[model samples]
Target: MYVATKGGERAIEAAHQWLAEERRGDRDVPELSIAQIREQMSLAVNRVMAEGSLYDPDLAALAIKQARGDLIEAIFLIRAYRTTLPRFGASLPVETGEMAITRRVSATFKDVPGGQVLGPTFDYTHRLLDFKLAAEGTTPEAQRKSADETPAPHILDLLDRDGLMEPLETSEDTPSDLTREPLEMPADRPLRLQALARGDEGFVLSLAYSTQRGYGRTHAFVGELRIGTCAVEMEIPELGFAVEIGEVELSECETVNQFTGSKTEPAQFTRGYGLVFGQNERKSISMSLVDRALRWEELGEDNTGAPAQDAEFVLYHCDNIQATGFLEHIKLPHYVDFQSELELIRRLRREAGAEEREAAE
Candidate 1:
């Protein structure tokens, strides 16, 4: 029997040093500064923040640099860091409608209230390789617009005013947090949103696109996608009222989908909602579509058994960190199990071959 080589302690220490050196890269090349990473590699930072369930862009940028821009590794860093932080009490839900607008756009409306401010988006930019970025040259920063002083009520709320849409109920129940608790089956909306917020962007996007292609089809329009800060208030039990704990920038998307009324009910527009960390408009929109699709049961629609319509399917598969980690970890030393399988298969084949020869004779 070949003995397995063992140098656990020394090897582990050596790996740590090597990782540090590799993360730093060539000493002469000059390191990519954290501020540079935060400003320039912000999209990568956004993904880490989104998946890691933490909103600190600077920390995310540092993690990205430390992980050599491998996003999964960066996510792991943030997750690890998040585990160390003390748990603060849950904050009161911020009225997202009152968010200090940074980026707001609605594709469905030509000119809506707060007037369609498309702040810092690459939507209209031609998809071309910019050679300047390879050498770090001057590219004009995305133009920013000052927001309007007074924002109007949500577009869907306007529909509600005319009795064309279903209005949201004022639920006073506290929402669940997925991070602290183990994800239970038959999750509530808060848990679903929490899962979707940290979900893989590509996976959620594909799920959203699937709904558009008629798998649990629902007519959806971007009612609004807004990115900005909302004051996170907390209920101080001693104070008998909620007080502002902190503020967080969030991306909120609301979609108006065509509604189907039951025999006793009048037809009204149904809506889907998504609110997530940071400036993730695409994720927010995708989440809204996915959210609506998951609500087929609540809406009294026939379950077509589509993957998007299946809460277990969408919720379980949405997170890249969980999916990637579990999928890729199989590459690690699984030799013991592999050898057992190999022996079992070999024995089975040998027995089958003997049986075949006897039968032929």
Candidate 2:
């Protein structure tokens, strides 16, 4: 049982008021508008949306501002708000093949069907800070081009045609809603994917890194990485047809791993998949590696005793909100619990001393 402390209502209220003042900062400086945050700090907003499991950019920006640029706090705020909203009908699975491509690349093949579109990336840029940005310099507008009507084909499809890659099994079963359902052990692929999609970026990235370092090494190659807007459709029961709802920017990564085969099965390249909100390629790639690592059991591979391969460890600790809650709660009053521990230790020491004295006597 936990002990409760009372009579800090005034102090708590005063602290909250002070916190508000601190959040506002200097009155002389102009306040950051929600639009500015939504546009300029888009990556931060994307992180909040991904982790919070909410897709509203406006609310995400608002949460970021309210949290004073603390992304985790912002995520916590967005998640709290998300819980209060009513659930509408779910949308049909997005057709990524039909995505209006912004950026697409393949490491497995030099030249793909659509070719490589660099888009806006920091890959080639030097790490040095641009002083011009500090002076409020404006960049020239980028050259515009006509939208390509041809749909960019998935790289996996090329491998699939030759039977080089493992064929994905289709499922008519509706995936469990992780938010609503209690996370059970030996979770299905759908549930694991859901968890990884919203898992802490740092934690997931570390696990992925571990795999690369030979901890649970899966010789993985980036088959394709794409970023684009995909149309979401919802089937209205009355219309008996699916209608376009809205578009969401997504980053998808498909990794081709080393071939896995048995005497009964043909050798085929294993695959890992990751799809995340916004232009978050890093998270997408990392998620894919971790996802692949977690699939050791399904793939009939040995459990290498790696952190990423342990479903319980990954699923239990990957949630930043849950992690912070438990960690931050330690600051609360635990006087009763501490006192009990203190008494027990002291009593044991006293008993030891008494026993020693008796022996000496």
Candidate 3:
């Protein structure tokens, strides 16, 4: 049985070999190149990168191919690979504010400073399956627009000028890296938001959906959702000035949620925030809602015992890697405990037999 297996190492290797053979069903057929995977199976790569918290498309593609198109498996590969790579130094926090925005939209505002650009999204597309993609050969579009050089403005800043929503000031303190560190309870706004962004999409979605269903309802509106590449810079000890290392794609979402305040405190609107590695709007949006819902305690509101309001609950359950690993590991050997139970049952039966003979005597 899969649960009684002892040689996990051998089983893993054999499974991988079989998977590799299955991945290339016909030996005569040409193999999939990393570039092809990167270009064609880009969505899978995107999800891996978003959840894995790594932005290397080539690595993501290879992981996807190696995992036989398993997205979560690809994520696990990325995470495992990331664990071994030596940490060269911390990069400066990417300035999303200064991000050369390809897409910027706000649901809470109309006629704002910089007009909303929908950019690349499937939101408007019909749910119909594209059978054309399954055709023998297809080259749909070569249309790709280069980004404009104009500076972009945030919609929330405009609202901040009007003094409607609570204005958040930028901080100079160094933020904690969730990947390198274990998450502590009672995390700050920034740390909590980071964890939720890279957290499991489905888990976050369910939690957010729960809030919307009146479990922890906070009237929510997508304040802004922006997607684009931002420069990652690092300060060189010798140079002192930071140098640009590279750029990574990101999806950042900010939500304006319902107001909560007492007579003593001013009625100020709260914010829910989500920021992810690659282009993942849904994950980011859901993260923001969950983030806001978790803020009940700090906002001086009574705990409604909502799933989202439970800090220990949301943070513990949000990660896909941890969740999947633990869940699937049940397939491995657990018979030591089972054997103990078996021995206990046998002893109980033997004791019952002896007691029966004594009673008869």
Candidate 4:
């Protein structure tokens, strides 16, 4: 039970005031505009949107500014604001297969149907930090290319033609929203994917690394990784057909895992898929690895007692907001609780001393 502390309201208010001032440090420096953060620190904004489960870049930038660049705190702010917003109808699933070609690569194949396009990647860049960026007014230009009219075919589709990859089962059932419903154990693929989509990047990456290290290993190969913008569409109630809403940038990773033939099923390559908001290749790849690890039961693979293989452990702990709330709460006012524990210990000592005195007498 938590007891309300007396005469601390003023102190709390003062602390909050000081925090606000600290958030705006050095008044002499030029203030950071929302646009600046939205354009320049785009990766941070993307991460905030992904983990916060909100897509508004303006709001994310504002939250980041308010939180003094603390991404986790910014996510908390966005999530809190998200709860107050009215629910709109869900958009139809965006088709990644039709994504405008930006950065597309295949690890399994030398040359895919559409040639590999290396779009705005740091894959070949040196690790050295360029000090020139520190100076103001640096305008960099990238080579332009004509937009391809044709939609790049998915690598998985190519494998499917050969009957080498496992066929995906289509479902007309509406997937449950993890945001709306309490996470129940033994979650389905859709629900688990939802959680992982918004899960902590570091946590997911670490779990994925564990799998690669022989813990619940799936011998996964990156079938394809694509980063591009896809059109989002929503169905109107009055109009029976879906209309284009807007476009959102996404990074998608598809992993081809080795699967030996089971008695009931023929030998074929299984898949793990990850699609996330923005061009976050690391998170997307990590998400795919963890997603595959969690499929041990359904894939007829043995559970290697790995944390990633345990759905309950992964789902319960993946949420950064929930994890931080519990962790940060320890620093709160526990004076009353601590005093109670102190009194109990004192009473127990007193009783033991009394017993000892009586025996001596």
Which candidate gets the maximum TM-score versus the true structure?
Answer: 2
In order, what is each prediction's RMSD in angstroms? 2.3, 1.8, 2.9, 2.0
Better of 3 and 4 by TM-score: 4
Error of 2 at 8 (Å): 0.5
Look at candidate 1 and tell me the lDDT of residue 262. 74
Rank the models by lDDT, top first. Answer: 2, 4, 3, 1
Per-residue lDDT of candidate 1, residues 242-312 (tens digit)? 98867777889999898768765578878888887887888889999998898888778888877889888
Query: What TM-score quantifies how close candidate 4 is to the native fold?
Result: 0.94
TM-score of 3: 0.90
lDDT of 4 by residue, 109-187 (tens): 9888988888878889998988887786667776867545468889988889999998996899999988778899889
- Per-model TM-score, in order, reads 0.92, 0.96, 0.90, 0.94
Q: What is the lDDT of residue 138 in candidate 2?
A: 90
| Candidates in descending TM-score order | 2, 4, 1, 3
Poorest 10 consecutive residues by lDDT, candidate 4:
141-150
Better of 3 and 4 by lDDT: 4
Question: Local error of candidate 2 at 11, Å?
Answer: 0.7
Error of 1 at 104 (Å): 1.6
Model 2 collision count: 0
Clashing pairs in 3: none
